[model samples]
Target: MRFEIQFSGHENIRSNHQKTIEITKESHLTPQGDCIVGVNASASCADLPRELKDKLKNSDSKITFSISVENYEFIIKGNGHQDLILTHEEDIVIRKSDFICPRTLAVKCDKASDLLPREMVELLRNPNTKGVFSITID
Candidate 1:
């Protein structure tokens, strides 16, 4: 499977509707189990002093990570690190007895996507795909 990371546009409230964004390769990730890969995108949010808090409140400059498995394509939101878009592709070994077509599959990430400011549940349900994508909160 191949994975690619891309950044897309969104509202930067702090910039007063300005489309200011920066893309860089400084992502880092720690892996778990035999399937999961975790990524850390930014170094600090500490510089957001009170004076700039409101302006940067809801701005998210997210990079898109896409994975192609078999004939299915799955996408997750994150940022890039070193030009490598991070992702975890697992080989889910299914036994004949438990091989029913599952409608959803729960996935756990090192960090948490539960409180992340976007909705992507529907994307995991593409007909071409075989499983559901879930963000387990830690």
Candidate 2:
């Protein structure tokens, strides 16, 4: 199963968090939101399809998450958990800490925002940059 969320870059996209990466439906970002890579997200946890939501609740389900912008792309491997709420209305988060919450999309992620390539992070500092967030599971 797969789906994609569209988003745009922001001026405050520092992409410097060590344990999590997030996308939010809010169009504005503050400097303290270092983990948020994209703003004006096209979707959120509450917007996920029922099929994908089911898969994300299964402990055995694995997810491949990707963030692509211009010519740069980063991939993260993660897993679902029974504890996932997947109901946050505004945000979706990929976590490296195995934590599950309403905003958590997938846990045990291989990379957080801080691990992204600096070049890619640089491009994301432009508010006009377009980006895609994709999730796939088999």
- What is candidate 2's local distance difference test score? 0.94
Q: What range of 10 consecutive residues in model 2 has the weakest lDDT sum?
A: 116-125
Candidate 1: stretches off by over 4 Å: 1-34, 37-60, 79-138
lDDT of 1 by residue, 5-72 (tens): 32212221111111111112223212212122111212112322333223222223233333333344
Model 2 Cα lDDT, one tens digit per residue, 24-112: 99999999999999999999999999999999999899899999999999999999998999999999999999887899999998899
Q: Give the TM-score of candidate 2.
A: 0.98
TM-score of each: 0.20, 0.98
What lDDT score goes with residue 74 in model 1? 44
Question: How many times do residue backbones clash in model 1?
Answer: 3
